[model samples]
Target: MSIEKFIQDGVTGWMSAHGEHSDIVMSTRIRLARNLTGYRFPIAFTEDDAMAVDRAASGVLLDTNQPNYSYMKMSEIPSLERLVLIEKHLISPHLANPERHGAVLLSEDETVSVMVNEEDHIRIQCIYPGLQLEDAYKKADEVDNLLESELPYAFDESFGYMTSCPSNTGTGMRASVMMHLPALTITKQIERIIPAISRLGIVVRGSYGEGSDAPGNVYQVSNQTTLGKTEQEILVDLGNITSRLIAHERQSRELLIAKSRLALENRLFRSLGTIAYARLLPNGEAARCLSDVRLGIDLGIIQDVDMSILNELMIFMQPGFLQQYAGTELSQEERDVFRAKLFRERLNIANAPASLEEDREE
Candidate 1:
């Protein structure tokens, strides 16, 4: 079955399995490449792409039944074959290390290294909690029923099955989602946020939120290691956070813009201009946060066709992801303009080309 239906009923089952004691759990720890330091890369989508993925995370959020986000989860086929394909772009040649497992870690020219493992219960990280932990708790079977009771078959066969990570058994869905909250995380008691997030059944750790929590403004929330939650449920939960954080982030950015200072603006500007990348400037021919939604739809990573997702994606633009996701690099001026304006003309959506004429004729 397609990922959609498999996830619909499956995730609800997983949510019900939350408190089941038989869940085999394991610890998870991964690292990013030390080289990735900039903020802009794969640029955010434009008003157009925002229209495409509107307020949702992916196309998955079109279903209105589950307004609560975690009603669904994200699932990608993580098989050896799939890994080989993704490795071509996302990572380097595979390592034959048994101890570290068939670990695949690589970044674009060492800018970002991804330490991912299925058994680690961390395909990525994310979270979902209610007014209290007890209120949020559910049975493990609920999660499993909604999550298809197995990892995507495609990912399982190729990546091989792993059973060591305690937190990655059962539902085996770890969603590492990042949400901007510069308003609360940056302005408040830089220390108290950790305790607050921990109380939510979510762990905040490092730039990516690993073991213990850190001063995370952009939340990397996810299910605990080897906990029971389905892809459907995870997506639903992620949607909830995505909406809330996007709203908060917008409020914070407005606060910054309204209270722009010589020192802070310069710091933000300098941060954009001072990237040490070998290719200092990226070409402006790719999808931009404000442009390209009218042009290349494939580059739209956060496409769910919702206003909330679009708003979040727009605010989430750091210089690094903007450049990386976009096939071309960006100039310093373009970056600043993007910051000042919510949308800019980054793509020539109206330009006619000989290639397009040929396609039409065919």
Candidate 2:
């Protein structure tokens, strides 16, 4: 799909479902890392080798008669368009990295996508909204099996799947949940809670995944160790811990309301006022504020705004997405102004009562 259609539809990937506890548990993702039987890893592949892998992947996708499963050359796409895909989690950071000769085969439903010649020969992923690890894995496995019949994968009898990284050698699966834990973050409990969770072999990463900061108090929690454990065992462990974190976050939200309702309301309303009326908005500031507004919606503090609108705003406000919409490169100042205008229009905060603004200031 074209970038404009992708954005206009707003019904792609993990963004589609409103799952259980969706207010807190944003989405779940399962990724499988695989390599071709004879080909070297993407990093070591010559130009010819990369093209060969790409062609082979395209052929396999052509053979699979699944309706609406389309393929595209990622390198041929414009830069901003790739960023839009990244923002939507339709493609990974590695796949979006510049000058990479790779292609992606994705279903029209946006639930499953496979990147050819990324970090591995093939990187397959499946995404579903909220906490659904078992379901996500099942879907990914089915796709992987279908692809296996078309192409042979590199494997070792004792080690299982062979991957570029030692950790992913066996199983080669990563199960992650995208979580919005504003309550825990605001309460400063995340300082302690995150570490304890890390100790349990779970890796906490940012919204865009590895090596990124949490922009909106949003975190991707996934299993750190995948080699020895069976895929089912890994899923259960992650599901249990994620469930606990969800419980803790809910408890923190209740405590915030019971102990300091006025303070919490004031914070939420003030954030709303700034996002709706601010003349200049930085990316980071907007993300943090949007997190507050999202929590407000969940807690019944804000009623007019739809959750889908806020969710779309979360990605739309990112710098690259902003530039793409602007149809040109933007300086930081220009982006700030563009972001503010977009937020004000989408949120319709301009028509809000003047008295609410006064109260927000108070």
Candidate 3:
């Protein structure tokens, strides 16, 4: 159950699953930020203090014995392995920094991960496939409660929990959903709705969370203001907005399929062709193409493909994931070539219907 074994096992994490509603809702994640009562934030800590915090947090996670969780030091894990963990959403962006003395306790199912000595003293995260905010929150809350008994968290009566970020002060809870909104993006509606959603206190970012572009029509939407609201309120508000976005995406899909069926089909099949035949495919291009093909499968435009494979590819196609899968470092050009070959093998290009192109011609 070590991080090495977890990586070697080729686990896809929670996002790889086709959950309750896998079509548009890719995955839902709940993150809780907490700090130790006596310790300063990570930036102020000496190396020894950081290591001490790592060990203390690891001890608490191990003592819990709640399920299949394994603790490992970040220093021991390789850079590529750490990247793979980030790709799987099992660790935070800040924790990926090798200079930091930190450890992560990861659940076997990859749904739960507790980061020790990251931005805050601890970051407990629970991720589930599809739109299951309530369920995700429940799991996260269970872990938070378990740790509360053993760890003295920094809390104030006026404000609920103290965190490094001002926006996360009160509840310290961020409930977010990774949405596949290709239809919205395709119809140019996402641009309009994103600002509107932001005005409602919801923050929208690219697939990798803050400071990343939405490369595959994938966006992570979450609440920006967490201070005044309770966990339930955050979830309720996010859930309502997410449900509306899902409706809009579906409606856009139906409209495109009806109004421009030929163009939509052309785009889907062209993507499939590129995946199957291209000699070189960049990660960004692959992601965008895969998103379209996945949407096609969901809409029944393509029936022979497996949604599970596509779900898995969404993780496997990342740079770190591909490098780990290859067992070595690769240059940009090398990765592109390898990616194309890998995609063809996974897609089974030999049997992919050649008629897809013919249909476009007709």
Candidate 4:
């Protein structure tokens, strides 16, 4: 499958709404970083060295006889197209960097993506929808095993898997789940939960991971220390903590309803109205409003709109996607206008429950 065809398919696999706690838990991801036996780390590699690593990794992945696999060189793809891949979470920001000599192999459904010559020689990533860390890990491990069979991996008996970063030298695995935590954030409980989770060897990052900001109240929670623990152990610890976090978020939502149902309903209805009728929508504003609308749907307040549309909007509203759909580079103002138009058309405003005024009277 060509990358263009993949883009045209829209949100699929991990980005779709499925799995446990789909309302709160957005997606789960497993990433394994590894270096080739004789090659230098990506940071120190010359263009030739990167190309060699890319060739080796891509060769193994493409030869797997999987009709669904598609491979693309980073240098050959357009800048906007690369950003689209990142937006879809099919590739990481680092892999999209033009200065990096890398290639990516992706499964047709986009559940698995192998990045070659990014921070390491190979990055095997598997993502699935909602609270499926173990499943994601299992898929990633299968890809890792395939690569290890054909390409030699750097390993240390003492340290386990060798990696470019010292922190990832052990299992070389990072398991994370993206969660929607608007209730916690609005109640100011997220501030406290983040610190507490960090103390427990679990780290919370933004939606796009590490350095990105968490728009739409979406955060990624993952294991912080991979050095000493076994892969199963890491999954268990993170899973337990995530379950607790989900419970807390649900409790917080209930608290809001019990404390001030009218106010909460008003806020959510207003959010839905804004997105459904607004003439222009900034990215940040759109994210915040969609978060509220999603909360309303989860709480059984908004019954008509499908959760899948919101999920697709989350990716389609991004800059890269807007431009890709437009078939041209868009100015900021053009994007805002286009975003609003897209939301208005996609959202089912005609059947949305009458303004909360009727319920307020009761």
Q: Tell me the whole-model lDDT of each prediction, alpha carbons only.
A: 0.31, 0.84, 0.85, 0.88
> Residue 15 error for model 2, in Å?
2.3
Q: Per-residue CA lDDT of candidate 3, range 1-362, in tens?
A: 76777775655556565676678888999999999877778878888778777777777777645676798788888899999888877888799887888889988788899998888889999999888899999999999998888888999989989988888899999999999999999999999999999999999999888999998899999999888888999999999999999899989999998999999999999998898788889999999999999989989998898877887777778889878877778899978877777787778888633332342233
- Please report the candidate that would top TM-score against the real structure: 4
Off by over 4 Å in 3: 351-362
Looking at model 2, which ten-residue stretch has the lowest summed lDDT? 352-361
The 10 consecutive residues of candidate 3 with the worst lDDT sum are 353-362
Point to the candidate with the largest lDDT.
4
lDDT of 2 by residue, 112-210 (tens): 889888899889999998788888999999989877888889988889898888888889999999999999999899999888989999988898788
Query: Could you list the CA RMSD of all candidates, in the order they appear?
Result: 17.1, 4.7, 5.2, 5.8
Model 3 clashing residue pairs (backbone): none
Candidate 1, residue 63: how far the Cα is off, in Å:
32
Error of 3 at 204 (Å): 0.7
TM-score for all models, in order of appearance:
0.35, 0.93, 0.94, 0.95
Give the candidate order by descending lDDT.
Answer: 4, 3, 2, 1
The candidate, 1 or 3, that scores higher on lDDT is 3
> Against the hidden true structure, what lDDT does model 2 obtain?
0.84
* Candidate ordering by TM-score (highest first): 4, 3, 2, 1
